[model samples]
Target chain A: MDSKKGMKRREFLKKAGVTAVAASTAFAAPNVHAKTKTYKWKMVTTWPPHFPVLGEGADDLAKWITEMSDGRLKVSVYGAGELVPAMQAFDAVSQGMVEMGHASSYYWAGKSPATQFFSAVPFGMNAQQLNSWIYQGGGQALWDELYAQFNLKPFLSGNTGVQMGGWFNKEIKSLDDIKGLKMRIPGLGGKVIAKAGGTVVLSAGGEVYTNLERGVIDATEWVGPYHDYKMGFYKVAKFYYYPGWHEAGSSTELFVNKSKFESLPADLKAIVESACARANISMLTHFESQNNKYLQKLVNEHHVKLKKFPDDVIEKFRTLSAEVIGEIVEKDPMSKKVYESYSAFKKDITQWAKLSEATFYDMNK
Target chain B: MDSKKGMKRREFLKKAGVTAVAASTAFAAPNVHAKTKTYKWKMVTTWPPHFPVLGEGADDLAKWITEMSDGRLKVSVYGAGELVPAMQAFDAVSQGMVEMGHASSYYWAGKSPATQFFSAVPFGMNAQQLNSWIYQGGGQALWDELYAQFNLKPFLSGNTGVQMGGWFNKEIKSLDDIKGLKMRIPGLGGKVIAKAGGTVVLSAGGEVYTNLERGVIDATEWVGPYHDYKMGFYKVAKFYYYPGWHEAGSSTELFVNKSKFESLPADLKAIVESACARANISMLTHFESQNNKYLQKLVNEHHVKLKKFPDDVIEKFRTLSAEVIGEIVEKDPMSKKVYESYSAFKKDITQWAKLSEATFYDMNK
Candidate 1:
């Protein structure tokens, strides 16, 4: 038995070493007698049709993935709710109902509060920090472990740099006025607000307008200038805010079913991840240009009334978040464990951010 | 006065109307500020010193900004906490104590529940969507409007594509196992976990290893293989997971004081933003190769144990998170307004992510 175990381990190492060599050769496949089989994948996302750079970003990923696989693998993308509702994407991929989908982790908050950890953190690390946690901070392993259970495989697809605060129907004045007010805030901030004695609401992408217009909710938070101006929010909400705390730096993903993912040739898997990574950077460049142009317009053409959150309100929320956060850690073991890890990561990275970005801005400003 | 306003508007329109013409004739400004001002800007980040990819990303931004400005914009970079604590970055920049800082939004939940919206939301848009919202979604307008009060300006800087889950001391069996667990989670996932009856801890990057080893946190999330492996978490944690739910696609930012940013030559501002944009993409590509190379070693050499999260835990979290997510929108009137605008944008653009990426992935996989 001992010999067999030793032999098995040795075999695994030998195969792995061979794989290392093969990989270095840029994915040249070993010759096979039989014809190679082609693969097809179904990818879904919550993004819209080819609208601008972002819409095109998805298309770009598809094009690159297909080409990278040398026509061996083909992917077809579906809009949100086409094969499954936007919210059901996790289940769709997990159940092998779809091959993959593009989304943000925060969207899956309904499944597990721990999921929020995978997306973005409130007052947490931005894209860089989040990336570190995921890439270097041991995030991928934890996420893979969590995802394997559902038969879902997730990959980092893209990122939107630190975001802007949301639009407001009324200007934020102080902590008192915001209490009990209705807003369309999502992610971890919702709980923070709840702790601050404020009410929170949720809705789908298509439904927020009517709700806001009809006074269903008093305020709403979204992304930044480019889309905000496109949506004509200035016409409805005169007061706009900046520096989103909830999202900070938001990330999107392409998730595939675990069984389906493992079934693919290693090269194909690499292709998909690589393609997604490419798209990730492409989206940022697209935003850099588009956001700049739209921002000039919101202020110049729209006659938009912009406002800021009151300092008192900001202070109040910051102070009360602990109550809400404490409950999360206290309520569940997994959450506590995840939280402990996250807190440490944040603390450690926090020291670095202080010197890196802070010093420059302080002096130059 | 109206004529002056009209003249300004006309000037702005001319610039936008024919970008090609502007691009062709826009002469580089003659170096006028002849003193060669050695302006020092504070830079802080969530990344540790010399950490490749993210750390280098931050450094790249500083280098590019300085060189592009002809050294007039000398930026002094400090690692996190070198200036102010990581969690206090927003306040540091907002209060003019620091010129700029790098961080994610969720960390600011303590400051404003609405701050969370600035970054990302669960089931929110991925990098593409987030960028669209920031650029065209009226997100920037709101962001700037909010930041105005804080006397700061934000420019999207670096990004990490999609992230991994985390490093775990043990394997996760099911969602139930998540209960009573300690995790270092951030952003929306932290809140969602609380909703799912789990404990979530906020942590920084540097501290995750010791916490996990010491049993301070059962699991810790950092970045992907390239970084996590470098950080040596595999030595302590046996299991690694995937499918980060917190951050989908995240982007970092270079924060500057409003007056300071405005004081710069338009070209300098443009240079800084553009440089950072390039850095964003560059970092993503760097990480891809870096992570892949190290991942093999983690498994082959380190004998790292890789595991997946149980389906039960993922499903349970998904089911319970709806209630948690719903709470964000209920507070504050403005959040609802922003959500309305964001929804419109999401509805319009989400279809694109599907038809392209979703289709290709589905067929290919």
Candidate 2:
């Protein structure tokens, strides 16, 4: 977490430029196409270096932008703490300290409560529904409108689909079992858990597994199988629960310094947007692919017990989620607006899903 | 379907050139950057001109390619019958009569039975699962290997999430209800329906509604609610069944003539690939958005009844689908290989979904 560990801008830019130029000009060293204007951009993320899915996805985004633009845009990515630290990514991008940033919008909920809708909500739309709202519905415009007030533009760059409920040391058979439980959850999810009488424990990513393992925290939801498997949560937790009711679909946002984004030439601008989108699709697919493979590994080899939250417990959580959302809406006008839009979209999409996706799943099972 | 309706290549190229030149030079008419070398490419699709989602998606892909490449690549899309008839699109692209094509892979199943796996299969993976397989689980590599034999390279371009099962004038109450019923279905779905004792009627898109209205076909499944609503199936059919047991997620492929694709500059090639990925994301979102809105309209305004196939009917269809898929695998070695891979991936992904997405949906409801 030391600032001293941060790579110098000049060093980062040099490496990025050289790597891109070298790859794009593999056929000819002095290719004129490679000589076209090259842009040096820096991206800071809210994930630890080489962190599973989230962090690695940012790295992939930079690489894709560089390769697709044929060296016209050389983007260097800095993991959390490597630049202005994880939580400061928004401010850094807003002040133009970095041209771009990769982080969850909910991390900045304190700045604009409405931003949390961009990340996720308890009982919110799953990844597909969220994408429908954000991309095709009016969610993106509202997201941009909210971010513009802070001098940043946001793109939904990546998602982890529907997250797992959490890994619990003991089975949560009913609502009473959740009363005194301590869990490592963040943002609005933590708030909901706290309201449901569970102790909300905020642990650093590196400490979560040990914290749960040592009974410092009784439960944690890191992500789905692919990520939790890597974090070795199953080593300590016997019960893995489903239906991440807290964060149904966690979307990662790419924040671009608005003025800097505007300054890019038309093609380079398109490169950035297109690359962000490709990264979005890549992350979801990557999550789905790896999670399934690893889920098999975790259960068959690691002997983790896969479980679903009891119906009564889920009912309790759902009720609490509604109350929590209502409170947020009641407190902030922007939150109210975003919540209404999200809720309406969710209602409509759910109807459609019931006829197609939900029905298919029900029948197949 | 007339050949005379097709636009001349030279004329299309001139118009594309003029459009790009005009837009890029709006601020300064003589800007040298606006003069980047342009490669005019033509893409032919299976959908009629201006068809919702499918055809428009192709046009959008062309537009994205044009913008992203900054005049380096100019693509013009021709819908079914514009450049060639609907069934002729694959041949046109493979023979280099056109640079690219947009159509469902199943449309070319006759040429290579394995191609249908790229589209969809009865009771197969949904959009999310399919994306995971194709993009991350080596499906795309296999697809390229298969298509390369025919002088084409394919990219997964668009998806229509889960399709509706079909529209029935009378309720499907049991397995016997399906017997002697005539339904307009296609691909493997038709075979499955036929196995269940339903008369499989193959009707063109334009005539499907009329056929259903006149009882020439007792039921049909065009797509999900969006396209189905557009086709006015709600007017003739009393019950709309769902969980599109047939093609769970229908994906459209973009076929690029291998030689033409290889001839493009590296950046331009990247543009084509990236644009296709964006189109894939866009189509799913657009479908999710529109389907929901239209489903409501279909139910409320048109007074169509939304229904799920009965448990017994679904069970029967499921068994019949397995038989149909088995027959395909038995008949074609290539199909057997593809099916094995798909089935294995589906089994794994289904396990993961059961834990996360499926469990979530189950509890939320």
Candidate 3:
């Protein structure tokens, strides 16, 4: 934990009049002031303090829960490195160090490979399809089963619609172009790069710009056009590739300590769930509304060369992605179980999307 | 109002233990038992009782608000013709007859042509883009301004993704094929069909199947496969078409009476708003998850021939749609203001979609 950031967050929470209250008081008596009892909770996140869209979504989620509960459940949000390191968010929440945590599921892949399926899969469904699967197509059951192992309950909090591939110093014309390329990509996408004879350089968000500028990494995939533009990746790299095959529509999550969550009354529980659902759509729309404006800025004002990965190169990556995912599923039974549901839903929805969304795009064009 | 249905709904409300409470009690004594005061709100919707997806979404919205508020704000939902006719839902809410109303905005086109852009337009943005404009872009402010004229506050409550074109008895291979077509379509789509040399037959949902079976109408446009299959459109119409150009992604709205809404405390207002947002995403996912399975049944078991509208015919419809929208905008200042925002957002987002979503689909395939 970073002490300065932690102290700052503490001061902010104090200023908001949030005090540490006994959790048991909430369940003390059903009729005697139980409804009016205020439960102050802390939420730790994986992004920097109030980082655009992602971190802001966490802030909004906490705010909505607090507002809807009418201060009955006041939540204080701590950014990455505030109360704990970014990577420790899941563990902190699971161990009850914090009441809640917000981050993407792929970040917990080392703990459980099955976690990656909840966030995004290379060549998997995009935001709409992903939401459909999780909310209605039985994906939530598998997710609940997986997270219950860590004593955490998960909710889909936000999504960055279809992302751009990466910022490239050199154009990727074919599979040959991938060889010897040092790129700062993460999760399954990084594994695919490593398999394609490329060097997968691990860099933090703050380090990515410097690494790309210093030629330590030849490319890096951030988020979509809006975040990419905000990161000023166009200034460091020349070409921006399209159709982020590695992360079609990556989902962010809000995980709460199971014991703590179960202890809350039904009203607060409903408030928390509804807030997450609200945050889920709010974040996606936030990105969708601004991505195009920033995309136009990057192309017209910044002169970023926008390009698509070649068909053969995309094909190779797709093949590699499948192989990587297959290896993980084969080793982990839980991964296999989750992947079965995900792949089945994907196969069916892809066909329907072809006739609906895909065809509508063509007609509009 | 249908007295029989109204009596049944009132009985159901009574069975649920909902009673009419004085709204003024919620604001009196900000400190003393104000938090415990219950608000009983009636929501009249333009759908049959517990109708799949749409009506169910309304039900869920009310349920969530009730649960989140800890029964402090209990909402009772009524189906169309229960307290008022389907088309009268807007006036009911506007006139304070009901505290809330649920239906698509385009259903109120007779009230104001500007309402059409908020719901759907011919060749307009789909679910994702429309949500973007409404939630993040400046569309909400315009919507608020327009709905204020009717003494209502509107929220985007649900969406039905991209719909199928229609169930056609005859194939449409060219622009000429649309000539003299009798289609039971409504709103902007119906106007486009009329302009394309088709007779627009205004048939209610219950009458569509009979009218199509008796050859009174050659075509009809309903929702996507899930609802259409349930409606048994495949049995009467041989050719089901792809890419519903007119109603791309229709958005359903939840409107509350301005006076009633303004009377609520901050927590109840937040609860209602968050519930609507939750309902918005819930409905889209519900439709997306089931449409594929039902579509498969329609094509495989039912042996329905799925077809795409011809390029020339789609192009003709697109042109006529623009002309129809043009006339409305030309005559109405509010329509012009709303369309300016809608069209601009649509234009920009379309370009972004071309690179991200559209290209991603191609890569995935």
Candidate 3 regions exceeding 4 Å error are A1-32, B1-32
True contacts kept of each: 0.01, 0.59, 0.65
Best by DockQ: 3
| Collision count of model 1 | 281
RMSD (Å) of each candidate, 1 decimal? 23.6, 7.1, 6.4
lDDT of 3 by residue, B139-199 (tens): 9999999999999999999999999999999989887787899999999999999888889
Please rank every candidate by TM-score, starting with the best. Answer: 3, 2, 1
Residue A27 of model 3: what lDDT?
23
Model 2 per-residue lDDT tens digits across residues B1-365: 11221234224435544333233233211222322445678999999887998889999998988877775577888988888999999999889888899999998878988898999898889998999999998798889989999999999899999998889989888888889999998888888888888899988888998999899999888888898887788888899887788888999989999988887667777788888889999999999999978888888888888887887777788788899888888998878887888888888888778767786677555
Q: How well does candidate 2 score on lDDT at residue B208?
A: 91
Lowest lDDT 10-residue stretch of candidate 3 chain B: B20-29
Query: Model 2 off-target regions past 4 Å?
Result: A1-35, B1-37
Model 3 Cα RMSD, Å?
6.4
Chain A TM-score per candidate? 0.86, 0.89, 0.92
TM-score of chain A of 2: 0.89
Each candidate's number of clashing pairs is: 281, 0, 0
